[model samples]
Structure formats: C-alpha cells, structure tokens
Target chain A: MRDGEPLVRWAWIGDHVDELAHYTGVHLRLGLLPVLLGLLISIPLGILCHRWRWAYPPTLTAANILYSIPSLALFMIFVRYTGLTERTVMIPLTLYTLSVLIPNVVDGLAAVPDPVRQAATAMGFSTVRRVVQVELPIAVPVVVAGVRVAAVSSISLVAVGQLIGQGGLGYYITRGLQLDFPTPIITATVLIMLLALVTDALLVLAQRLLTPWARGKGAAA
Target chain B: MNGFLNQLSLVGDWLTSSQQWHGPDGIPHRLLEHLTYSGLSLLFAALIGLSLGLLVGHTGRGAFAVASVANLARAVPTFGLVVLVVTLAGLSTAPVLVALTALAVPPILINTFEGIRGVDPDARDAARGMGMTGWEVLLKAEVPMALPLILLGLRVAAIQVVATATVAAYPGLGGLGRFIVDGLARNDYELVIGGSAVVVLLALVVQAVFTALRRVVVSPGLRAPASGP
Candidate 1:
C-alpha cells in the first residue's frame, strides 16, 4: 500500500463535503438542543427566584456546584443510567447550560430600572403584561448575552460526545486519531472553530437588532 | 436503580483496594501527574494572561481587542484542540499543557483587566498626588485594590484546568482520567465510577481552597461591609 496521506489535504475536504455537511448538521443539533433545554428550565426558574428574592442565592449556589463538575465525568456518569445514548450526552450538556444561563436571566431581570418598572405598573399593565411587554424587552440584551456564552460553550462541548460514539464534528477527530490520518482531524478542528465563531457573530448581530435603542446611544458616544 | 447501586458498590470496592491506592500505576501517582499538568498549565496561562491584562488595563488601550479575541478563543473546543495538538506534537505532555494553557488564559486575562479597570478613581488620584510613578501607582494601589478579582480570575482558571486536565489520558498521559478510560476499555464500570468520583472531588477541593485563599488574601476592608440592624 502507498504511504499514508498527509496530516491535512485541502483536496480531501473538498472530496468529503457531503460527509462534512452531515456532521455539521449533527453538531448543530447536538449543540442547540441543550441551549434550548437550558433556556426552557432556567427562564421560569429565574423568574421565580427574581420574584421571591430569598430563592436566588441557594439556587445560584447549586448551579455553581453543578457547573464545577467536569463535563467529561458528568457525561460518563450518565452513561450508567442513560446507556450511552444521545440522552447520556444531552443531559450533561443541558445541565451545564442551565448553570451558565440562570444567573444571567436573574441578573438581567434585576437590572430593569425601578422607575421604568413602576411606570409600567402605573400605566395599569397587568403583572404578566408588564413582564412580557416592558421588562423582558429591556432584559433581552443581557439574557441574550448569557445565551450567547451558553450556546458557544455547548457547541464546543458537543465534540466531547465522541468519546461515547455520539455524532458531531468530533467523529472526524476520533476517526483520524485512530487511523493516524491528519486530514480529517485538522479539517474537523477548523470546521468546529468556524461553527463556533459564526454562531457567536450571529448572536452579536441578533443582540444589535433586538436592542436598537442602544444604537443611537452608541453613535452619540 | 439497580445499576446505580451497582456502580456505587463497585466504585467503593475499587477504592478500598490497596493495590489501586499505591505503586507506579496507582491513584497517588496519577493524582500527582494530574496536579502537575494542571499546575504547569495554569502557571503558563497566568504569566501570559496577567501581564497582558495589566498592560491593557494600565494603558486603557486594547481592552476591547483583547476581550474579543479571548472570547473567540474561549469558544474553541478544548477536547478537539488537545487531540489536534497531540496529533501534530506526538504523544507527549506538550499537547495537553498547551491546550489546557489556552483554556486557562481567557478567564485570568479578562478578570485581571476588569479588576484593575474597576479600581477606584479616587484612590488612583491619591496615589498620583503622592508623587508615585505610573508603574508604582499600578503596582502599589491599583493591583492591591484589584487583588480580589484578579485572584478570582486565577481561581476560575485553576478550577477549569483541574477539571479539564483529565482528558490528558486520551493522549497516553497519566492522570486521574486513566482509571476512567482504562476501566471503560476493560468493562470495569466500578473503576470508571471511582475515577470520576476522584476527579469531581479534586475539582471541589480546588474550589474550596481558592475560596479560602480569597478570604485570606483580600483585605478585610475591601470585603463587603457587615449589615447592621
């Protein structure tokens, strides 16, 4: 047999476009599900804590403890119960997102200026209307900031699922390592970084669109 | 439920084994390797992050640039980076160290910059009025005031490195993770569980130690004042 291929070849990336697309789809799915799950759980929890006041510290402490658990260990520990399926991979990723997002949600809501909140109340808006209409609009930027961090982190971590034979761009990294072929590994690494950077840029753009009032202030500065 | 109990019992059994506790391939040796990898990486990251952060904070320039770059780097997957580096560098400690150092830098750098930037302007004015040089004002007044947050950055980086260094096992380096990988390969689920427990424990201990260090190092005056009735 001929000697093995070089560590990285641009031609191989072109040749494997279909396979790369499939893995990119898998990567996005795996990364995104956790962010959605975390947001689903944390938003209501954050709202509850924000309203109650007493619940915030303990809840945040618990989230911190959960965050400190190594993601790899958390993934393996779940394998016993989840049986090496996507559930095993997802449960840990979702928990990590919650750990990052809850505090941001709470802090964002807390940041609503007292006068603005009171002004909404004086206008005879119901509590739910005030929250959804007035408070949430102001809090969106901060909450979105948290989501941006969580989303990028989840995307990076989805690659770790390769250890348990889960999909994502990590497939190439593991496969290349096993075969000692550089092309797939290097190609996947660059692709994963690109995915992360592109997603981050999109989030920044979304934030700008959502908070148009800030544009005027920014220009003034 | 049964599987959970079984894993717990298996881990307990594995930990009780004196053989696993001592010798060349034992827990102590593995723990030492894990700590060494984490410590060296954190040290290197601190050196790079702190100096650059200080320069950025002092000059009041490049703060935004440094932060944007750090945020992007933070988004790079650590596992992928480690494997990629190892494939290029061969199966030595370099890849793990390099990857983990990259992982550790952002928090330290960001925190140092923020901490120094947050220093009280009044205190800075006082230092300047006392005829201190720019370097002296930064070293004496600004850094000390920023110590709490700077240490906070170090703590964050250190804990992250400790938790992440376990992946070094993949590249043929010895660490607490060896037990997890080896056990999984051998179908020894107990060893895997036990190894994970050790890693989680190490992370918690590191966090607690840093919390204690913060209390000791941060001046009492700088701490939040006690609430009075």
Candidate 2:
C-alpha cells in the first residue's frame, strides 16, 4: 500500500525464508502445546465431571468465565507472575481450551449407549478398563470435534500474543502494520490460516482412522 | 500473596484516580467507543449471518457451502485480519469495523443454520399439515423452536466482538484497548492491569445481559431443564 509497493514481494519472501520458517515453527509450538496440555488436563477432569454429575455445572461456569476473558487481557494478567515468558501465553490458552474440551469429552463419553455400557459391565470388565478400552474409543469422534475447534482457535489466537512480544506469526503482522507494509501482514495471515486448516484436516483424518466403525454414522458429527 | 495484593491495589488506584476519569481519553469515553464498535459490528454480522443461515437452513441447500465457510472463517486470525486490513486501507475505523464484523459472523451463521436444521421433523410437518405455507412453517414452527440456539449464537457472537473490539484500538482507534496498548508502550503496568480488568468486567456484564435476555426471550415451555454440562 505504500507507493509502488506490491501486496507481496516474492523477493522479500525469498530473502526472509529462514526467518519465516523459524516463526512458523514457533507459531506451531505456541499454538499447539497448550492444546496438547489441555487435552491431558481435560480428559480426566471431564471424566470426573461426567461421573460425578454435580461437578459439571460449576466446572463449566468457571471455564466459560475464563473463556470470556479477552486473549490479550489474559496474557497481560499472567504476565504479572509469568513474566514475559512463553508461559504467560500458554497458561491462558490452556485455560481457554478447557471450556471447549471438557464439554466435548463429557458429551463423547455420554454418547456411549446404555446397552453397550451394560454389555461391557456384563462381560466383567472393570470400570477403569471399560472406560479406557471401551468408552474412550466411542468418544473419539466427539472429542476430536472439540479438539478441532480448540486447535484452530488456539492457533489463530497465538498471534494476539504478539502484543506481549510472544506472538509467533503475529510478530510479522504487527511489524507490517508499524512499518505500513502489507507483505508481511498478508504472508503471516495466510500462513496462520493454513496452519489452522491443515491442523483441522489432520484431526478429521485422525478421527476417521480412529473410528472406522463410525463410517456408517456419516461425516463428522 | 503480598505481590498479588500489591498489584490489585495498584489497579484499584488506577481505576479510582480522578485524573483518569475526565478527558477525551477518559475511561467513560473509551468505554463508549468500545461499545459503539462492538454494537455496530454485531448488528451487521447478525443481519448478514442470520439471513444467510435462514436461507440455507430452510431449504437444506448450500448447507455444505455454509459449513465450509464457517470452518474456514474459524481459522482466520482476528489480529492478522485487523492488521492486514489496516495496512491495506490505512488507519480508519471502517477497516476495523470490517474486520470485527468478519470475525463475528461465522458463529451466528453456523449456529443459526444448525438450530433451524435441527428442528424436529414432526413439528415442521405438523405446521405444514395445518395449511402453513413454506414461509409460515419456517417462521411459526422452525424459528420459534430454534430460538434458544439462535439466541445462543447471538450471545456468543456478541461476547466475541466485545473482546476483539479491544484489538481495534491497535489501528489508532479509541477504546478500552487504548489503555492496554498505551500502557504497554509507556511501560505503565498499573494502567495495563487496570485496563484489562475493565475489559474483563465489561465482557462479564455483556455475558450477564445476554443470559437475562435469553431468559426473557426464549419461551419457558421450550427451555430445557437445567442440566449438567
């Protein structure tokens, strides 16, 4: 948008390939590590809520409240304790994931038909074993659905971390803005979108491979 | 624990200072700007998303297109879009509004489509059997039934817009985000903390308002019993 400046200069991209690649890698890690950590935390917590019943409402309320906080505000709040480290960014992102992941995990588990659960019990399988080996498999499609949403959202949000100086691809976006340039902004945005879409597609594929039996159930729920 | 209390007090002091309350950049003025940006964007998003969702959901045609667009929209980063648009259009409120509306649309559209599409077939058929036209069935039977989810969609969109409207400040627009962004630039941690607290409070108030609206607007008969997540 500056005079004589093309929307994107391929020569600039070619020159900055190494820099772009580094940011891309950082972007993936910043965007995804929290999702992976969230899954670890959410699965057990979701199961607890599912089994106890009483815990779900308060737990959901807490997560929803946390989710409502803006990403930048959450980042700044955490900066008080976490300093300027990546932890500041990841902490809020992980918390945000809980609102999406827990419900999906619960719903996925609840989707297990009573008769199927009865059969699992009648077959003398222990509760833990039934949950892990029998129930979790049935829950994959639904949980994956939540994961897909969380992953894309997390990836997109990682850029907002730039305000605190931790934004991955977001750095280029801000840089482009400050310098009144469009190439980096456009390039970074495209890459972030691609990362989200690719990650979502991979999750869909993983769901298919994991739940071949659900082929008859039609496209993802 | 002491440090936490210290920070809280700092934020409180910042919030209460008389100097912070009166001027062009005052809290009240910025808060109004934030609300205006959020309100305008939400209105536009609702108009576009609701109408498109109704058309696609009613006919069952273009469902795939709607789903794909929603999914793709989810992947687009709000910050990136804002910066990208600003860089292209130069600094102005219009680009920011465009970006915020774009960010808010997918949820409303998807939820509206799904809510309508998910209406019980029996109810739809019953409406038709009673000599209702296509429009009548959609309006009388389908939309009323889908009211809860449609309201839910609006609520989600509203909250999201209010939060992202903070980023609209990055393009030199005035809003609550001015405090955070300016605070960061000037290394005023107290101001940053105070500003973030206000934004969080505003979001909560918005959430509460939507919850109250849902209670009033959604029919009690259609309301599902309070259930665990």
In lDDT terms, which candidate is top?
Answer: 2
RMSD of each: 3.4, 1.7
TM-score of each prediction? 0.93, 0.97
What digit string (tens of lDDT, one per residue) describes model 1 on residues A1-221? Answer: 01665667888889999989999999998888999999999889988878998887678766766777787788889988888788888888898887668878887899899999999999999998998888878888878888888888888888888878784998998887777677888888788888888897898888888888877676211
- After superposition, which runs of candidate 1 have C-alpha atoms over 4 Å from their true positions? A1-5, A219-221, B1-3, B221-229
Clashes of each: 1, 0
Q: Per-chain TM-score of chain B, candidate 2?
A: 0.95
Candidate 1 lDDT (Cα, 0 to 1): 0.82
The DockQ values of the predictions, listed in order, are 0.42, 0.63
Model 2 residue A177 lDDT?
A: 87
Q: Which 10 consecutive positions of candidate 1 chain A have the poorest summed lDDT?
A: A1-10
lDDT of 2 by residue, A66-121 (tens): 88788888898889998988889999999999988998899999999999999999
Docking class of 1: acceptable
Per model, kept true contacts as a fraction are 0.48, 0.68
